[model samples]
Target: MLRRITLISASIALGCLATIGPVLTSLYFANRDVENRDRADIQEFADKAMLRAELVTYQAFAALSDLEQQPGAACSPANLEQAARVIYNYRYVQDAGAYAEGKYLCSPLLGDVHDKDLTLPPPDYRTNDGFLIWFRQKSPLSDVRKDLQIGRNGHYVSMDPEAYVDLIDPARRPIAAIQTTTGTVFAVSAGADPNEMFNAWKHAGDVKSDEWNYAVARSSTRHIAVVVKSPRSSVVGDRPKLLAAWLSVGVIAGALLGWLAYRRVTRQLSFASTLEWAISRRKLDVVFQPIVRLADNECAGVEALVRWTLHEQAISPEVFVRVAEESHLIQPLTDLVLDKTIAQLGRLLAANPAFYVSINVSSEDLRTFRFLNLLTKSLQGTGIAPRQMRIEATERSFMNADATRGVIAAFRAAGHPIYIDDFGTGYSSLSYLQTFEIDVLKIDKSFVDTIAQDTASSVVAPHIIGMAHELGLEIVAEGVESEFQAQWLRTKGVQYAQGWYYAKAMSAGDLARWLGKNRAARTPDSIGGGIATGSIET
Candidate 1:
């Protein structure tokens, strides 16, 4: 159960990691792409605004220069007519005239305005090229309140201040300004304060506020700076659509990767690995099936069987035992069985010297002396005699007689009786059985099940019994599930048997209670099916 839970947790953690990786990658690149596009748009707007400011300044200077070359007195008729032509030719110039002693002398729309009170205020700024500029000065001629004035060479041009920022679309509500590099504002749009925008651009070439994204551009050839800004919402439009598309792809890929990871790890924890884990942790259980003396139908000994339960599911011994042998885990598995059998039944066997428990071992265990050494150590201080723990091996374990002969002899030398379990089911013949000095032969359950049945296999059991008798071997009939089979085996001189005819295999505590009940009722009539016919009294 714990192993199952751990496997599930590890798989989920890996799945979450796989999922988060692609989503984060998509988000990072998406945000970066959007920011880059917005920055590019803002930069283009700033560049266009700078070009407009430069063009307006260039046209003002050009008109002033043309008016200065009129070839007569500053306010003469020819010069005044020339001023009309200058105003007509220059698109941004509203007025062209002569100025001296800080007062307008004459021209064009207001001809000879010397008596018109056209005195100019102090110039707002002076350029490096000896030009004077007045930003948004009130016009004396009419209610036109904001005009830009520039003077050079005793001539001046007056222009509308709105021309510097007129390119902006009013519906978009963008903020724009044109100013000198020294922070003199020429013109500005309505939404944002000119001084604040200039200060933001001065400290940072471009800046982002909660509501806006700003960009700045400066003209190297003129004392001009342009600042432009757009709303943050406009720059991030359509971003939700992009996020949805990328997120869908990420979820699909993450789910695929996560599923593959889960399968790969689950496959790694197969039955072989699980069985190995159980043996190492000592989680396997040992149960004892009582072997009865056929003559008196009394319990004589037992056979130790190993069982396993995984995740509330019982794993069959036949399946897991084969898996262990094939995967080379049989030796450790046999060691665990031996250790548990001794630990659970050691005291019981010590008290009853006539009782012995048969333990099964694999072919690999008999191929070396390691198992013999382990057996010696397991019984050293347990007060359990070697004869009380009989060693049982299947016929397949005797395949290599030369390799196993020494180990078998060592076990017998240590006072352990050896029994060959599931006999007549493998390659051992009567002549082959003569090769090892084995004590007992356990007839296979298949032959025992065939007793009294009208089948050809029923005759095979008699031949196996006759063969064991000729070889001077004790016979223990296996899987005798009925009184008829038990009576037949006892009539054929089988001395011992183990099957569900008496009781099923059980735990140590249950077996103890069973033995107590059987001992208290020793009469022949107390046995199951009232003792088989032709049975002898013990």
Candidate 2:
């Protein structure tokens, strides 16, 4: 029942990870796209600001053209005032003035024309390409520039940094630099990664300012690019609501799926687990499968194989052992099998000292250090020499070389021999054979069962045998079922063979009787009713 719950929990956990994986992956990519868009949006906004600056720069040109168009139009103060008012009335024109070499004769749109410091020569300014640069930056936002100061208007104005802005109409952020055809200069907002943007903009930079992204380009002034940057925090500010809604839906769906999976699987686990215990308590019985030396047809040992005593209810070691391993019951069951086999071995000890007994201990049982001590203690004083005991450890046990060597050393010192079971199926087995000191290498059943038919197995067998011989190791080829395969193994100088070809695993009494036959069955195919009638009763 508990095993059922554990399996259900595992399935549910896997389902949750599967469902959440994609959602988190999508969220990561979505945020990256939003950041790219934010950069584009800023650049677009800057482009528009550059456009506004162009209008200011070109107005000066128009003023010069107009003066030439209307001869002596600036002769009278009143007329000049009227012209200044007309020219400066254009939208986005903050204040306009005309200064000519140390005199501001008149100003339009301002009540006071003769203002302070008009006598100062052009306020220490310069003109380049028919445009003027100011000694100091002029800022409309400051109160000092509230009343216009008169000057000669020697083609000089305040630095453009104060006036630079990429507006959503009226609002502005100061920028790095903007240059005019008439050589007027305006400061540009230093948006993030501005150097990259400026290169793209000045060389016909593109505008990508969406509401979520910002990129502004100005083709008019040789492509001065402006990017209004929204910090990542703000750019992704609105995403939380959308992501939250999606996340909620995903989590709810995942939970529902998990619940269903857990419920259905847990119920199945309960059923399977119940069956297991039921079989374990009343049905589990040991059957002896004789491990034989094919060369002389002599019994070397008998491996204790398990069976469900309930006939017509075939249970698979494939499924049974798997669940045992997963649920951590393999260790307990291994102990049970080992102890029972040893007790059975004790009964046969007097009959034959040469006959060894082998039991399969799971990989997990070996890792549990306590298992070793417990096993050793149980076998103590049984008059069972460690040499008389042989343990078949599956490949998984040897996967951890350090641990396997440590345990094997302990077992060997205690007079027990350890064989790596299910060889050829795991990684680095040949390498391990070279590195670790082991007594036996049991070939995997897959290769053992197909020795004659599989070319790979046929070729690999010789190489394996040679390697084992080089290592002074004994080789046990399991799952042999045919006379031809057995004879082939004998010819290959295989030391041991175990499979249905000799005898199916049978109960202790049956095994005792069978061994009492005292005669070797040479041909497996000749056995009557697919069974061996030969029985040895000692």
Candidate 3:
């Protein structure tokens, strides 16, 4: 009877372990999936918002084009006024105005006028004194009448919380300001707040939130308008909610299965803990992908991509990074990558002095002064010229305004060339371009993926290269996967290119021979300097 009681108790304990193990594991993986999905959803929303805003702008562009036709029934003050009203009255327009000479064509109070008043600085960045874009009367100084301007295309600026509230406080009145690109401007308080205005503009897919942060922008007219909306509650529960919900259900179904294997799972969990502990010992390394110039088919440099492996099993960088970040291991990993890449570059310089390395940085790394200081000290110790080492700063680099600027300044003072990586992937690409002292712009692969297609990329790539050149910056066309893609980029005056066309992420041992072989092939009529070893990594 005592032996029977012992067996029964042991069975219950085993059953409990069996029930919980799969449930917990399921919950963990499900949570990861959900978090990844949320990120994907956010990215999709940003992309859609951009496309929709551009479409709205094009409506204004059509108006501008019609007005320019002039005198042949294509242009009229009434039609111009109609287009102006369509844009001004539209929620997405934020503000729209027509400019024939200099003046307040759309100001509800200022009516219409052409005048120059340079004595006071423009109001609200549109006119002087940060008040009314126009004066009560004209002076010779304000010659901004003829300077018709439109907001930059694809600008995603948000105004008042039009989509959030259904009503507004009578105390917090809404106002609309107007301005011309040439500096003419005016303003007027709205008859109804944006909450009232938003009611009429409702569409098929509007969502709501309590608090949202916004980036403001303007149209051709200085009138305030809504362009894009971001949901910034930044939910922490999102990381695990889906997993938890699913695991709760999965556990009920797996009771028998769990009972059968309860002992094995406890053992595995203990093993996982030990394995994780071993991973924490700071034994990580980095590998790099050579970024080759498309024009001559020779290596321009290499981009450092990170890797992690232990006990013959390699962990996913994505998962490792997420967990590592949670536990404050990112700094150590970042340092390891930087040191290894720098060391590799130093060795490569032994045979080839011109080769360089582009290292990726995380938003966390940018926030810490210690990491930046360590970087500076490391580079200085290596004796590599600052220009030879390019720091590939992504949109993530500037998450904190003050710290990011401080970090950039430190590196810049040290003579390091800062390259903006994945330039078009973020919503703030143009804004970043205007604000940062960027020396090179690496076009994101998604945009470059369609270069061979007879689509927007064929036209857009050249325009980007031209624009970068105008800004005195070099363009690096990433993801050049085909000979046609390579040929198209070269024709468009893009000098540097990098992608699978050359090599994959590799060790310094194989890269040496690969670089030497490709370097030699670029000389004198060697298949028009084509990378004959297509898809070859030594």
Candidate 4:
């Protein structure tokens, strides 16, 4: 009775421990989502503020231009009328006037004030394009004081500083400012000093203070920066609700975890047994996807992909392979693939000396010489050279540098070329590549899918290609679905590619017939037919 109680207590404790992981994971992702949304909102606000500032500045300059082209004396009636017209047309402009010799000569408000000696103060700032800016200037002839002034070529315009950020609703408005790239504050909303906001922006492009979240946007062409900040309460306001919800989730998850653990154990056991039986019965199959030369569309080689079926349902290789790895059955699974590959295409490979078949292997296979032994044993009487059976290991396989290096060296020494599969997806580094003497780098399909699209991953392919070229490693782009992608890869010096644009994975007979048809036709568009399903010898 005591031992049973102890075992139950331990199981409950373990269940709680496992439950913490999912609960914390859920909370972490929720927090991240909120933070991301906050960031996007502030960035958008800053951008809109910058654009508004730009439009205000452009209108000010345009008003000055119109006032300058009044077609008469600087303080004439026509000039006053033009100033009035500009002030009426431009919503941001508070006053328009004519200036000369650093003095306001006249305005529609203070008509013909040439003799009043309204001397303008020196400009607070000057833009690179010869426009003078005054941050705060007292009105010479009106009660309105401290309006922003911009002057160029004997014409000037005064604008309300608040107009730069007046587009947003007052209730939801954030503290914002328009400043120069050098942090000169010109216009700002209420609730904070512009200098403090600029200082925060200078310290970090985006920052979280005790009470606020701050962000910045900049225009290189206009040389202006917009700084905006919202209250931190807006982002963390739902913490109480989140805590309540996630606590409930944690309790439910704790209860479900035990059931899941039980199911997982049973499932793994059943899967292991089923896989062992399937391997013994030779029930697994191999399909070949042709890797063609991008320069001429000629069939260069094929990558052997393993497939499995259970109860008339196709099982993904990723699923079964992972179970095999966990069950310590990867070696037998690999042996089956190699045996079947040789059985199906052994004669074709032996006949076509230039042809090769790339086989995927796990990192465990590279930890020792057992895989090499298996390869040699499998090809002993097949009349296929060791080079014809190329070895492809994922980037993850190189994590054990010392072990993988020796095994890779052994594979290379045995006349088989070593390929780093899914080059950019995992454990990728220039130093890692330099450490391993690899022959080929296969670009993963994810990166290839981004080709010709405006996305972050689109540039990754070119960088990968360039890295491969600098290292003198051959490149093979996977998932090449469009001719545009093919042409793009061709221009980047990628030698090989494979995807639906050419042909999908097919059986041994289909690959043979596909190769034979391409050989006969010998044209770039010969493989345009969708998937190969017929048979003919090469």
Query: Which RMSD values do the candidates have, in order?
Result: 42.4, 36.4, 21.2, 26.9
Off by over 4 Å in 2: 1-260, 275-283, 309-312, 452-454, 518-538
- Could you tell me how far off, in angstroms, the CA of residue 396 lies in candidate 1 after the best superposition? 0.9
The Cα local distance difference test for each model comes to 0.79, 0.58, 0.54, 0.80
- Model 2 agreement with the true structure over 1-538: per-residue lDDT tens digits: 8999999999899899889988888777777776666556455445445544544444444344333333343435654554454354333344444555554534444323455434434433334444444434333345564221212223222223334453443234334443323222234444434454454434443434343233444444342333343434342577686467567878778777988997898666654454445433434556678888776676777787765533477777676677767754565466567666766656564345566778787775565344556567676777656676787887767777775677777777777788888787777467667766679988777776667664666666677777888888999988888898888888887899988888888766777766656234545543222222232222
Better candidate number, 3 or 4, judged by lDDT: 4
Consecutive 10-residue window with the lowest summed lDDT within model 3: 151-160
lDDT by residue (1-538, candidate 1, tens digit) is 9999999999998899799978888777777776777678677667667666766776787677667656888898999988897888677999888888878898688878888778888888887888888887777677857788988878889998778777745445345455554576667777767777777668655554666678887776577777777765432367676466567878768777987996786454356656765775678999989999988878888899999999999989999999888866687788888888888787787666677899998888777655666787789987778898898999988888888998898888988899999988887676558778899999999999988789988888899899889889999999989998898899999999999998789988778877877765787555544212121111
Q: Could you give me the TM-score of model 1 versus the true structure?
A: 0.50
Report the lDDT of model 4 for residue 252. Answer: 64
lDDT of predicted model 4: 0.80
Which residue segments of model 3 deviate by more than 4 Å? 1-282, 310-313, 454-460, 524-538
Q: Compared to the true structure, candidate 3 yields what TM-score?
A: 0.46
lDDT of candidate 4 at residue 229, scale 0 to 100: 75
**Candidate 2 lDDT (Cα, whole model)?**
0.58
lDDT by residue (1-538, candidate 4, tens digit) is 9999999999999999899988888877877787678678676667667656766776787577667656777777777888897898676898998888878888888788888888898988887878888888888856666888989878889998888767644446555555554466767777657767878668655554656677787764476777777765343477675466567877668657977997897577667667765765679989999999987788878999989999999998889999889877687688788888988888788776778899998888898666776697678887899999999998888999987889899999999999989889998888878898889999999999998789989899999999899989999999989999999999999999999999999989888777777776665465443322232232
Point out where model 4 deviates above 4 Å: 1-261, 523-538
